[model samples]
Target: MPNDTILVVDDSPTEQRVVVSALQAKGYRVITAADGDEAIEKAGREQPRLIVLDVVMPKKNGYQVCRQLKSAPETQHIKVLMLTTKNQDADKFWGMKQGADAYLTKPFASDELITNVTRLY
Candidate 1:
């Protein structure tokens, strides 16, 4: 079944709330993780349809978390979107290499985030 749940991961409380609010306003069932470790745990447990992950974070980081999630059979089916402040070409390439379904930098417009999330589904 298609899950409407979205996991938003970010270390910054302000950023997390902003993303969560935007997603919630669109009627997505939103959950949160303060860091990569929690994100992994929540993903496996919650099985959200999509994860909006931030690349720079305490421990694990987004790339590491995405790679692990993609490799793990239990959570591999979930789509990952790398949301980060790093906008460099190399950063994006690395995110894709880590098995991210899509990559979007921080300071993004709400519609842009929604568009990518919708595309993933």
Candidate 2:
């Protein structure tokens, strides 16, 4: 397996598992967070090269987490891909406005996610 660690953040257990499975299949070392709070905490502690962040979650949302992460020197260099069910253009704009490096809508194909992640990583 590759040594590149990726942090997967999502509130849904099923969704999280799917993301983890896809990333792991491609040989990435994966860590998971169930909510935004844990996402931020683990991102700082693990210092993963990339974070797959969900827009909707308990505690802080993806935008908030992304904003904070991008603003802080410790985590600002880390890249973030916002993965969510919100497919609206405005949502994508908002995510980008909050410092997300990329955005992907849910029901995403494994290859699609991998493509975006690898590009950002």
| Tens digits of per-residue lDDT for model 2, 37-75 | 899899888899999999999999999999999999999
- Looking at model 2, residue 24 earns an lDDT score of 93
Model 2: colliding residue pairs: none
How large is the C-alpha RMSD of every model relative to the true structure? 1.1, 2.3
Write candidate 1's Cα lDDT for 1-121 as tens digits. 3277899999999999999998899888999999999999999999999999998999889999999999999899999999999999999999999999999998899999999998996
| lDDT of candidate model 2 versus the reference | 0.93
Candidate 2's TM-score reads: 0.96
Error of 2 at 9 (Å): 0.2
Q: Which sections of candidate 2 miss by over 4 Å?
A: 1-3
Each model's lDDT: 0.93, 0.93
Worst 10 residues of 1 by lDDT: 1-10
Clashing pairs in 1: none
